[model samples]
Target chain A: MKKGMGTITAPWKQLLLNALESNSHLKHSSYFQLATVGCNGRPSNRTLVFRGFQESSDKFHINTDNRTLKIEELKHCPFAEICWYFTDSWEQFRISGRVDIIDGSNPDTFKLQQREKSWFASSVKSRLQYLGPNPGLPRISEHQSEEEVRLDPSIGPVAAFCLLVLDPDQVDYLNLKNNERVKFISTLDVNGVKNWTSERINP
Target chain B: MKKGMGTITAPWKQLLLNALESNSHLKHSSYFQLATVGCNGRPSNRTLVFRGFQESSDKFHINTDNRTLKIEELKHCPFAEICWYFTDSWEQFRISGRVDIIDGSNPDTFKLQQREKSWFASSVKSRLQYLGPNPGLPRISEHQSEEEVRLDPSIGPVAAFCLLVLDPDQVDYLNLKNNERVKFISTLDVNGVKNWTSERINP
Candidate 1:
């Protein structure tokens, strides 16, 4: 077992961080599933792609379109839990957190830099609501092609309604092997400091 | 848009069913993150695996250790939405549902079929307890080896406690593409019939 600075020092934590850092697949496509309670008190969940994480700031960022039901609900209630897990590895990170929509400056510059030209163009074009199959409908271009679209300027409106910043409240780490299953529970204080403890329970 | 069976078109409904059916990677995982509300009214999510799904019954099942916090709170509140999304396809499914503990003969059969051989061995060896590191302590074995442990009829006690079943109330399908986004919502009525509708949404 290795000791770490995050108030939780266990083998699993180190393993988790290593997995997150070393696995490009996890970084590339890990979707943060956000869960929120609807007006009727039922739970709701939506997938938000994992954008970036600032360890020093202890904040994670994700991009979302402004019109999602999740965004609408978050306006009414900002509390949510974000979850990510790797299918190949029996490891999962569940973050319970409060969400805030960040509409300042141009965060899309960062997102644009991370994406390929094709992906960025596709994303913008798709934003026009033209991908679905509708019989006898005229087609119109919604976005500029890769060569014509300018990143610096394109970042403005995209960033205007793009990023979601989550300040996690608690995190649960679970690892399951053939015989052993390990779990760690880490609760975050109001200041976003984590206090973690471990418990082994029946699998 | 094409119109057919019970509010949802045959093509779209087929797409929804195929998305869930063809995804073997999603099915084999041991745990899935379930988002719920904590006692403090904060969002909480934890990983639990896909147990089984009954097409005939239109129900999904997942199992968890009896001692987890979510299980305790779930007894008080059964409303939750389960989210599962595949990274490669960016395909997402959100199931709004009610949770109930499965017991009796059906649950017993489900447990035996769903649990891997290693899981049974771990339970037999001991109730795994999470203890902080003790210097020079002997390593405890959760299971001797996979082959050494056989399914004992005596293990029925532990088997009875961990089954959970979710009956979906509504399912939202989000298919994100480069040019447009397609959204489908399906609600299950009291008589266990499903009604679905689709609309194009701005991404």
Candidate 2:
């Protein structure tokens, strides 16, 4: 079959939803590798949890700390990609997109609202990670109370808390059961309108 | 403890070996995400299988088709990172390194020998993938015979078969079991000797 294009949003959203449901039993299914180009064009990657999409749109959500190295890397280069694998169905999704960081310094009110909403939606344990000392910093003591962390749900996101929204331009969906692959590409027009095209490719 | 410096080789090799032993039951534990920078500084990522280290050294091995997109991406930018997550112990390793591609065109017989050895080590199914049409091309048929593919192991690597050697300079190991993180940095001295330093860090 020929490639098909769309104008509204990412075409792989439905397939991704199906995959998520199929592999809901695995906790790490939501965990994916977020890769960014660091200083001097070196590649940096880390595992992060999927915070779901914004409403029904393809704009992805990920809550991170501003003090993390990725924040600095993203500041230098906004282009990034996330590679996610679902072991149950043996599905792999490589999504390449441009990341927009909404931190304490962001001026966009709408983006800030989304960040606020994400922070409140997270579990107390998840929110407490942001409360801890900056990631990668030397740990002074061994005891970090996984049991004692208590954050007020009403309190908004702290200063270090940041939200990353990835506007995906391409997605490579591969199923290892048969090693079937599909590529979905999205291009923008002059007025900033996104058009998506999907094609079945050899694995 | 404070940071440690080693002049011989990567200190994290022991930890990685321990991880591999602990998660030997899970098949996908051998899989990880490899991220590379594409044109215009964009980031691309995909899943790949780990082919173990080179003898006692930390030099990583991965086999890929030369015609794949990463071969071109690596040509422009050899810097890449592989993020591996172990589900059993909740450990993640982020290894950032420069990749050396040893394809058919490679001049070094030594590197080509390694490539040949890797091809011989791979299964018949893996070897047949390279014989198929180029990656990302439209699939002409849906049924690709998964079985009934046989190749003699004594034969050498095909022209499309390529070996990737990742010489890591930095490794970030995070154990979510206790949220304990360690940063391993390797610096090359003037004589091309690598010195590794490790420090306990916050997750």
Candidate 3:
């Protein structure tokens, strides 16, 4: 499997890798806006915590409840986008790609290993979300706290855990400090080797 | 023409109205991520400043340059969503709605009036964005700075200013402080009058 951002030669890719690796801004602001296509061809967006980023293959990693609307939306339309903003550095990254869902049922051990790693990485407090009632549905009760539900004997890992792999085919980087924005479009050539064409765009 | 965040009886509606109206957190961080559906059936998102919020009809207001890809995306798919997070209050709001784009060619005076008001509301620095070369396109020059581009005599508003009205049909509010989340779904019943249903979801 592809690993660190070291092998990426493209400037935009290098920049994104540096951001995610250095933990300057991307690390501090772990949450990003996730956008998905609805059945009616519209977009639905919500904020999700950034689980991981791998620069080698230009992939963003996030976790979600399998029962959420986003997962259902992805089943119909797997194309998705994620936008991240580093407020301290005044930089914004818009990553667009087709989603590859990796759940416990996937045949590949790599995906299963990743899912297990994510589960272990999550703290008790964080894991409580997945253990509680399904997202977007009515709450169990108005007064029940998340911790209470998590502590309930009936709840454990709560079967709805899934890992989403967003393989970015396009990355748009905007440096708002100087109004300099750039885009990197990835395509495979005749050799089937991935390549990216970068250009400076009007902000 | 929804005026203010007043007259909304639903608890989630009232919560959103209060947040936008109070401006404690929303005002401090005026920018939020705007998500749209691309023709390729994928999602695209970017950060844009919040122009206004009218609670009466659950509309979120924002402006964009007509030449941007977002306008093209919205034209093909009018359904969109916006995600706002008030860091200070630890509150996050995900709003989904249909878009109503208003431009110079639009006939409605109310929309036109709103557009004019937005124009008047913008500062010279803020208006420079519309004056620049089309967004997502190649930059005008490798050496030209945004201020230099703004000061150029040839550049002006370029008639690319547009107002986008997001008439929300669903709203999800999550309070990270206590892991309490709620959803407000707006529907039109047999009478064709808008009504909202509120529910507390497990976070």
Candidate 4:
């Protein structure tokens, strides 16, 4: 992975590295808009949290249960664009990439060994059809103990519908106040050699 | 316009009306991600500032120089989507609407009279050709004096692309918390009337 401000030498690799090293605050950012194409040819967007980034494999992952429309649509087409912005710093990054869904491997013993407990809990609760408009809908507190909820079989790899792995092809960075923006486009040939070209934008 | 959360009868209408009011903070919001369709059948997204909103007209406006790529693409196909989320509130709104470029009238003379001076200043600076390598750059130096930059008469009305209105056909509201996430999807017809039936989904 390479890193620089103006022209990205290795766009995808550099973005993966920068996203990983991004301030801890950014890592925890809750508002990321993902744009995907719908069957009607219109774009669909929804906000998702920045779950985490994996450095060694150079992939950014977000977990969603099998039920969400986005995950279901991705099963048919995997191209997507994700945008992340830090409101305080007026810094924004846009990643356009393809998504790969992981289902066979055990998330607990994943190559990165990064386990998201909250994601698991949410997935388990989601599968129960426990969510509805009424207050009487089953509550997490009523059914399972905290420990049981944490270690529930349904909350692990089996519970997850898909693990979205983003392989970025381009990253656009913009600093609002400075009025500076850069576009880094990545190119990888059949042999797997990767290259990136960066260009400064008039912001 | 409408008021009160429960005052609106239909669920879809209530959601869209609430979104319009809930996102009022967007009037003061500096950054917005506007997603449009590219000629290649891919979705394209970029950031813009929220200029103002006219409740009576049910229009949300964004200020941009006429020369921008967004403006160019918008002229060909006016459909677009805008997403906004506030930190203080976990509420996030996605509005998919249409863009209408108004050129004959002074954009500032519209609903944003309170911010005319600031808007005028920005309009002047934004007319300058961005020096960077990227296309359709954002405006730089919010503090730059409008007096220093000469406005080109040819670029007067046509130069400022005001109020990319989104007549929302569909809106999705996502409220996320530590334990539960509530998602609602509402769809409307071309006349902006709600379809009444909305799906509550597990996120």
Number of the top TM-score candidate: 2
Better of 2 and 4 by DockQ: 2
Q: What is the TM-score of each candidate against the true structure?
A: 0.65, 0.92, 0.87, 0.68
lDDT of 1 by residue, A13-54 (tens): 465566576555654335557787666666677666665553
| Model 2 regions lying over 4 Å from their true place | A1-9, A142-150, A189-191, B1-9, B141-150
Question: Which consecutive 10 residues in model 1 chain B have the weakest lDDT in total?
Answer: B127-136
TM-score of 3: 0.87
**Model 2 residue B154 CA deviation in Å:** 3.0
lDDT, candidate 2, at B59 = 87
Structure candidate 4, residue pairs in collision:
A202-B137, A203-B138
Chain A TM-score across all models, in listed order:
0.60, 0.91, 0.84, 0.66
- Give the poorly placed runs of model 3, Cα more than 4 Å off: A1-10, A17-28, A54-56, A142-158, A190-192, B1-13, B17-28, B54-57, B146-158, B189-193
Cα lDDT of model 4 by residue, B16-133, tens digit: 4565566557432445577776565555676667655544334456765555676676776678877766454455667676776644354545434423433454544564432122
> Pick by DockQ: which candidate is best?
2
Put down candidate 1 lDDT per residue, B1-203, tens digits, no spaces: 11121342323446545665666565433234577766766666665666555434545666555556776667667877777665545566666677866533344554444343323434453423211222112325555454454545454434334556676656556655343444555665785457666665433
Q: For candidate 1, what is the DockQ?
A: 0.28
Q: Interface RMSD (Å), each candidate?
A: 8.7, 1.0, 1.5, 5.7
lDDT of 4 by residue, A1-203 (tens): 22112232344445444544554464335457777766665666766666655444445677655546676557556877787776656667888878876653545445223334434534455534322222212233433323343344454444444467777777888776676677777777574655667777565
Clashing pairs in 2: none
Q: How would you encode candidate 2's per-residue C-alpha lDDT over A119-143 as one tens digit per residue?
A: 9889877888887877888988778
Model 1: per-residue Cα lDDT at residue B175: 59
Computed on C-alpha atoms, the DockQ of candidate 3 is 0.73
Worst lDDT 10-window in candidate 4 chain A? A129-138
